[model samples]
Target: MKRALLALTIVATLATPAYAVLPDEIMADPAKEARARDLSRELRCMVCQNQSIDDSEAPLARDLRLLVRERIAAGDTDAQVIDFLVARYGEFVLLKPRLNSHTWLLWFLTPLAFSVGGIALWRQARRRARTSTERDEALSNLTPDEEARINQLIATEPVSEK
Candidate 1:
């Protein structure tokens, strides 16, 4: 019975919408509403940072949602609407930023950083291997007198047997 209740609860939770778009915020025209929703999904919630404006309950997200709907209703093309938001909020408003001169670093920095790190790690490993080889060579090339003294020290050490 408890398992059945848990399954029902999961189903109910999944069936619910997880958006912050209130009924009053929805457009009367379905086409405009759809466009607004699409644009909202592309925009980031300034307050929530990682969430889309459509999914965030922040006041700033709500304002952005209204602004998108207003633009759509004002007959702005999707591209124009996006451009306007980009102009106002900068590229940070875009969930997926465009690759331009200013945004090149955002798109390429991670892989470039990783490549540099990998090269550095490889050089470090090679240097350590070379150092280890040099140390072993130095130990192997000890003078005969040094070898004799080492043997003498080992022989003079007391050994206890249990």
Candidate 2:
């Protein structure tokens, strides 16, 4: 019964629509079509919430795709089309926002953070190693008899089997 229930749950989950975009609406003009597809990849589908315009079936995505084709057909360059969209919809419409003064930190912070973290980790490891060496030196000062007693105590402990 449990196996049957799990199977049914999996089937139902797979039945749900992952995307609703239809292939028929894609343009056939080679250059313009490529630009349209590229623009679609850059633009976010607002209606679908989390999909790129190319992958979304939302009405807004269809409109945006058509807009891209229209602009490209009108002899607008890809950069111009992107600028127009950014001007009309703000930078939020772009999947990858441009790097500007405000975004400089965002662009560079990942590497900066990793470098800082690496330095901190190295310092901490060095400190630990130094402390461990000091501890070993102190232990070495103990007579050989003391080391033998400590090993014997450890060896006499009971072992637990899993």
Candidate 3:
């Protein structure tokens, strides 16, 4: 039973999809292969949406991994390979998107929205405070006759004994 469990554990570990880089996709040149791996980590897996091509098992991720290796083997610099993919697939294929005029809103809109909301909330709180103060003042301004009548009613009532 112990031997069978040990064999099962080894098989499960080997079968786990740890990396999407196939053995055949690896380049012969160590330097080029390293560059390809680095580039793959930055490229997004379109099918998976969140995983990098290096970590995704999707067919599109495999295709992208091959493309990166091909580009590196052809002597393209890391920046050139990234630019090529970005041009082909748009900035969506990048795990970290570049900042540009088109993406300014995407980067800045959250803080801008939070600031607007905070200001509105502060103004509302201030208005409520002012209204509350006005209500208190109105309630306290009883007529002199009304005050005397209330005093007489209080004097006429019998006090409860403990």
**Winning candidate number (lDDT):** 1
Tens-digit lDDT track of model 3 for 65-157: 998888887888999999999999999999988999878898899999999999999999999999999988975797888778878989999
Q: Write the per-residue lDDT of candidate 2 for residues 11-130, one digit (tens) a residue.
A: 998997554345665667877777788888888887775788888877888888888888888999999999998898887788887899867888899999999999999999999999
lDDT value, residue 145 of candidate 2: 95
* TM-score of each candidate structure, all chains considered together: 0.73, 0.71, 0.69
TM-score for model 2? 0.71
Better of 1 and 2 by TM-score: 1
Any idea what lDDT model 2 has?
0.84
| Candidate 1: tens digits of C-alpha lDDT, residues 53-158 | 9999999999999999999999999999999999999999999999999999999999999999999999999999999999899979999999899899899999
What TM-score would candidate 3 get against the native? 0.69
Following a full C-alpha superposition, what root-mean-square deviation does model 3 have from the true structure? 7.2
Greater-lDDT candidate between 1 and 2: 1
| Model 1 steric clash total | 0
lDDT winner, 1 or 3: 1
Model 1: CA > 4 A from native = 7-17, 28-31, 142-162
Task: Give all candidate RMSDs, comma-separated.
Answer: 4.3, 5.8, 7.2
> Cα deviation in Å at residue 41, candidate 1?
1.6
Please state the error at residue 159 of candidate 2 in Å.
9.8
Candidate 3 collision pairs? none
